[model samples]
Target: MVPDGLALPDDLEGSRNCGLVALSVVARCSYAEAVRAYTDVFRSAYQRHPRKNWKGGTTWSLVVKAMASLGVQHSHTEVTSAVTLQRLAQFTRRDALYLVCTTGHAQVVKNGWVIDQRGAVPVEQHWGRRKRVTAFHAIKED
Candidate 1:
């Protein structure tokens, strides 16, 4: 399962790489590995050297590139303005990790919880009131 061996950092107090952190856990690898993969994807796809702090933060485009580099297939769906816990539970699957995004943040949802650098918490608690879910990335097996 995706949750197996997945662990979060003790404190992401000052980190701006929530997307990378979530991707690392979902990819089951180290944060450095995730940064390397993101950089590789950026270089290969854009044909330019990524900024030194490219991996320090994330954007929607970067997330897509990272997912592609990690061999995870993804899709975008227009969700309603309000995504309740029940809807989230029904939208997610057990074997896959769901990369969810709101207005300014991204998180990994697995097994009814939000898996981020801080830790795994219920989706309702971490999700807050910003409910503009723009995309969903489903991790694929090797």
Candidate 2:
């Protein structure tokens, strides 16, 4: 699903940092840079300690704001339909970037490639097994 030279060359994966890692890949930045950007947005948008709710999983709002902080534009509207990740394209543009959020998880989608803590892979090989995507943040094209 990923084109040549598209996946993060040195992805910094975390046990519970799928959201951060996805942001890192989609923003095309280092994991450290993604963290810093997320921290800035987390402070302003969430107004609470970063990772205070991490155990509960990162919120879609935090992910979207972090993208904006890194200059990756996205649509603020959150589609709450319960669709599987594979069916995401039904609601979002096929060639766009998005922060696809499941009930308690988040991953980055770009041109049908799913980027998570495990790195970029075909959306089918993603955190598999019928992920009912609860939210979708379509990154706007310039």
Candidate 3:
């Protein structure tokens, strides 16, 4: 049964789609308090995993899952200085950073904070092959 005002995502993978939906709702409602409460729950779920801290407690997969549960489908852009200050300011008393990416395609840096997709820059120009057509130069450099 649906809880009083609780809404469910169309997909059974509610853990994923729910977040995007929640974001939409919160955006429309401008309900930051409700949004924070929901996101806090998502963060708690993420921390439950045993390996959560292995990779700085910040894995793309877990971030995506947490966002999904909260109804945020996309990722944020770069992690910049200003963005860092902004995101740090958003942290609850709990001290967990909510991951928001710029675009849904893949993770990319934006501002200074690691948020969900907002806008994404193409990899072809900066990361694609130099003279090698199919080979990515960035990979070779590493």
Q: Which residue pairs overlap in candidate 1's backbone? A: none
**lDDT by residue for model 2 (1-142), tens:** 3753346637464453878877776777887888788777666765665554434245667777788888987665555556788778445565778777776777777666777676677776776526887776776656
So what's the TM-score on candidate 2?
A: 0.76
The CA-based lDDT of model 1 is what? 0.65
Tens-digit lDDT track for model 3 on 1-142?
A: 2112223222323123323433333222233433454455545765767564332123334434544454444423344433322333233222222223322222222222222223222222222112111100010000
Worst 10 residues of 1 by lDDT: 4-13
Error of 1 at 107 (Å): 0.7
Question: Between the candidate structures 2 and 3, which one is better when assessed by TM-score?
Answer: 2
The RMSD (Cα, Å) of candidate 1 is 3.9
CA lDDT of each candidate?
0.65, 0.69, 0.31
Q: Could you tell which candidate, 1 or 3, scores higher by lDDT?
A: 1
Count of backbone collisions within predicted model 1: 0
